[model samples]
Target: MNGILLLGGHSDIGGDLLTRLCAGRPVVLAARRAWTLTEVAERATAAGATEVHTLDFEATDLASHRALVDRAADLTGGLGTAIVAFGILGEQRRAETDEAHAVEIATVDYTAQVSMLTILADTMTRGEIIAFSSIAGWRARRANYVYGSTKAGLDAFCQGLADRLHGTPLRLITARPGFVIGSMTEGMDPAPMSVTPAEVADAVATEITDGKGSTTLWIPRRLRLLAWIMAAVPRPIWRKMPR
Candidate 1:
């Protein structure tokens, strides 16, 4: 049976997307804390997944990523999709002052993502690798520069990688959503054009199911124009805007 794998299965968006993608398919939910996914696995099964399995996945552990990919392929007949949904929205203030915190943010958000995506690209014979980027990457704000910078790097990498996969069976979809109001941003004020986890999942599922296979996805569509406007803003003015 073919399957869908969620690399960051514990996140709200990941959980939402998993339910949407798992219909009539086996699913592998891989996360740093796999044991806590009993409820998620149940939800996937209830949503029509043929079967569900949770695997221990450490984002920073590059050495074991390939093995994890191999196991997923082995468990199911093949992977229909692999969602790279793991990332850290590190505290900007703390990251600015602490070197360790900065490195943790960069490593998890960008480095780990690239490593897993590279492995998935090389190993998967047929599937799509969906990654979550943010509109924040379009232009780094002084308030959250550390997180934004990592997403910027990831977005650029995924774009170039998509170009390189021109004739390949595998594809990459980089989703750039505006501020997502969710558990991740519990106490923070919502930004304009904020989207819910289900909304993001629905848009992505439609893109995949309808064969859009577009290299990039702009949630709510208007984010595309907003991204351009943000990119064109002068640095002096950009730095002054409160994010």
Candidate 2:
């Protein structure tokens, strides 16, 4: 039996996705601290996963991504589904002065995602690649352009990749979640159309499994209209608009 590969099982969205998905199928959870995530596996098992495997995967460690993909394929006969739910959000002030911190987030958010997807996409003959991007990518937000820029790059990358993989049995699902209630966004004000882990997971499940052919999934569905309105606004006005 094949397995579903989740690069960041430790994530709230990732865990929710795994719980709702992979029923009766083995799941492979990859993370930096593999041992610390035994409960992740247990929960997946309880959620009807056939089995669960753990792996060491550091998002920023680009060199190890090849090895990670190799290991994932070895565990499962073929990569049926790949969910990249790995990311980080740090203090905006700290990231401003710390050049290394800024670059680290950017690399992890964009560079490493490309590397991992390339490796995973190559090995995945037929499956869906669901990437957890953010609506922040749509435009540069004054509050968090550092992170926004990274997500912007990712969103564009996914679009091009989706076009490239056209008619090849390889599906790419770029998920641009608005404000998600998760560990990362703790203490922050949830955006207007905030969603939950389960909701995002459900949207992805419906889009991919049901053969919707929708490469981009804007959470809450209405976000499609919202994004259009946002895009039509003048840049000068957009810059001044409060987030």
Candidate 3:
């Protein structure tokens, strides 16, 4: 089995996906503090992963992305799958007023993903990429548009990348979930049809094993319908929606 590369090893969703998908395969977990993944690496190994390795990954460090991909490929033989899941949701009000904070949010949420995904596409041999997008990007609202905009950009890029990779060895599994109620959203009010990281991971794992094409997975399933409905909503009405 080719090794799996988990780029955002610190995220809850990444960890769940690692445990769920890496059975009988090698896994390379990458994050800012690779040492923090010792527990996750152990769990992955216990869950049937042939071996587990950790590497320091700084998403914002674009200059190092190619090297990171190379290192993972070296350790795993050929990375069978790469999960790009690092992101940050900055305070909406602060982002609205502060240029530096807004740039940070954009860099971390959108720019970093673009940088890493681009490198992975050029480097990976044969496999799939599970990218965790968000339903919030379906239609931006005034309340959290800052974060939503980043996701929207990411969603569009992945959609384009999938089309570009058509008929290729690589498959892009774009997973978009509604407000996730977990450590990441600990203090925020849960949105409608919110999902857990485990749920998202299960959905992703099922989609991959089912041999599905580069289709988007909307968690809770109903979000697919809701996204269409929201798309048709007029901007005036959408702007008035309370967070």
Better of 1 and 2 by TM-score: 1
The residue pairs that clash in candidate 1, if any, are none
Question: What is candidate 2's local distance difference test score?
Answer: 0.85
Query: Whole-model lDDT for model 3 versus the true structure?
Result: 0.87
Candidate 1 worst ten-residue window by lDDT? 205-214
- Judging by TM-score against the true structure, name the best candidate: 1
Per-residue C-alpha lDDT of model 2 across residues 1-243, encoded as one tens digit per residue: 257999987899988888888888878899988999988898898999887889988898889998888788888766788999888876567788999999988988899999888887788888788897888888877778888889999999899898888898878898888889988888888888999988998999888768559888889888877888888989878888655
Badly placed stretches (over 4 Å) of model 3 are: none
Q: Considering only N, C-alpha and C atoms within 3 Å, which residue pairs clash in candidate 2?
A: none
Off by over 4 Å in 2: none
In order, the Cα lDDT scores of the candidates are 0.89, 0.85, 0.87
Order candidates by TM-score, high to low: 1, 3, 2
lDDT of 3 by residue, 75-190 (tens): 98888899998888888999989989998989989999999888888877578888878998988899989999999999999999888887888878799999898888888888
Tens digit of per-residue lDDT, candidate 1, span 70-92: 99988878897999998889999
Error of 2 at 187 (Å): 0.7
